[model samples]
Target: MASLTCRADCTHPANHRHLRFVWLYFTTVNLSALDLNLLLVFHTVLEEKTVAKAAAKLHVTPPAISNSLSRLRAVIGDPLLVRRGRGLVPTPRAQELAPRVATALRELERAVGDDRTFDPATTRRRFVLACSDNDQIASVPHLAATLASEMPLAQLHIVSIDQLKASDGLAAGIVDAAVVPTAASHADVHAEPLYVDHGVLVLRKGHPIRAPRLSRAQFNSLRYVDTWIVLGRAGVGTKMMDAFLHRHGLVRNVAVIVPGFAAAAMIVATTDLAVGMPMRVAVQLAKHLPLRVAKIPAPAMPIEMQLVWHARTHEDPGAKLFRALVADAFRDKPRR
Candidate 1:
């Protein structure tokens, strides 16, 4: 085959890379003998760094992926991956081909319109959802119910992720989607509004600070159990609350710093430590825990939840349906 050149006339300058991804293929590959599926396995193995993980992501058996890897190694005439301790590490050749292979696969999938093949009814698959502890308690049941009705045989695997790195998880297929506080726009991810509410101060029902609201002096006297309410700039751990306190020369003392909303809620319910979180979640927690909700003084922490997914799965029909189910499950206006 004659050597092929990359895009010479693509009008969009930014898309020059997609055409370029093919250059590596045409330069060295024989069209008739190359198995695109093998390339998919190759890309997945590289991304996952282990055969078992790649197999799980591709919904295939580990031995099947191992055999595919052997075949890809033979086809590429390189040890594309080699065992290093417990995980596989890509060879330098694979490292060079990694991004190109990913981009090329994406472009090919686009050209081939491969996303239409996803049939939720018949496809028994596992989907991972990333969320905070509160979402796990307050939101996952509804999302799971929706998933069961739509894709009865499918499995839902819920996991916790650092809010700042949730998009990275989506991009890597670590999680199919995330339910989180609204984030700034990113070029590679899509975020849709899930719900909106304000923060409430969570406390034990018979606490000393009995008012429905707090005066600055009362607020300052209270000790707090700080927690990362998972990635929202809305309050407490972020500037939204600290900056508000700064204007009034008020300060909150941290009695404890827990990792999750649930833990913070527990500590606050048993002790006098107060924590601020979304009103909807607070009310839900109050129903089960000895918790009470109060407004976060003035300028309550604004809570805007969003459903996020990476562009890699943007056109996927199953992913689309999953996103819709999540949106439907949690998009209700906060009742209090």
Candidate 2:
């Protein structure tokens, strides 16, 4: 016969149940009775905070969630849910069960998370990642070097995109992950912060507009060489710049709009146009061109770089390990 087991911690109002969780332990119910599935559902419901959302997450109907909550209440002898606003709120008892229940569930999940171990040294899986040209030039080199030396069989494919995602390409697995400015909106997607970058103004060293100190007015008056590539691949830079200009009631005369920073740099070097780029990128371009970098008197508007991945892959052994490696490689190494 199946039986339900109640832990002492479940005595709280929030964790109390109407339907006792049933567990079959070797066809006997002498000392233990617990339904692990119900606990998982309970956890999801608490996290979501609404029965409808929990049902959607679990692929069930709202009534099923209510029934489970009823059972939980009866088993624990407490009104686990009380009406508040348009939803049910957990009481003090429910809050106490949260951490302990979560810890126990995590321990169980870790024990069953993977059936086999991943050996990066021997695996030959190829990873495809989408990122900007700046990331390709500045970021991938170190990753390539490490993978080549350590995981010899692993190959990395870098896909350069002008914008992060115009649609759900990443959701459909068109790309494994991307370095995006903002986290993807999909509930199943996750973004981990990598680094922050700031912008700088660049121009020819001897240009007339290259004042010892370029005021916002002087900076706006000069013809601007705009990079059409759009930082973070979604016209993010254009939007950010436009907002700042609007706030200050300034407008730039865009002399040219090119598809890349390289093109913008080339135009700025040969013409009387100024370009705005991240400090590191400007420094890099300066090495090969006759250009100089100028500090914007305004406080640098910093943008964060994040590693965005699908939620389904978040817990994968290989993906997690590789993500750790990538994060460590890009960890804030301030420019000397």
- Per-residue lDDT of model 2, residues 289-328, tens digit only: 9999886656677867888877656676777767766666
C-alpha TM-scores of all predictions: 0.64, 0.59
Q: Could you say which candidate leads in TM-score? A: 1
**TM accuracy, model 2:** 0.59
For all candidates, the clash counts are 0, 19
**CA-RMSD of model 2:** 13.5
Model 2 misplacement above 4 A: 1-115, 161-167, 183-186, 211-213, 230-236, 334-336
Alpha-carbon error at 169 in model 2, in Å? Answer: 3.5
**Residue 288 miss distance in model 1 (angstroms):** 0.4
Per-residue alpha-carbon lDDT of candidate 1 for residues 1-336, written as tens digits (9 for 90 to 100): 001123333334555575575665645766555666677888888778888887667655576678777867776778989999999998998887876666666655555653468778887888888877777777788788878888999999888756435334664456888987686887567889887877678889899889998888888889998775445333434566667667766677888877778888888889888987777678788888999888655675566778998776788788888888877877774321
RMSD of each: 12.0, 13.5
Local distance difference test, per candidate? 0.73, 0.67
lDDT of 1: 0.73
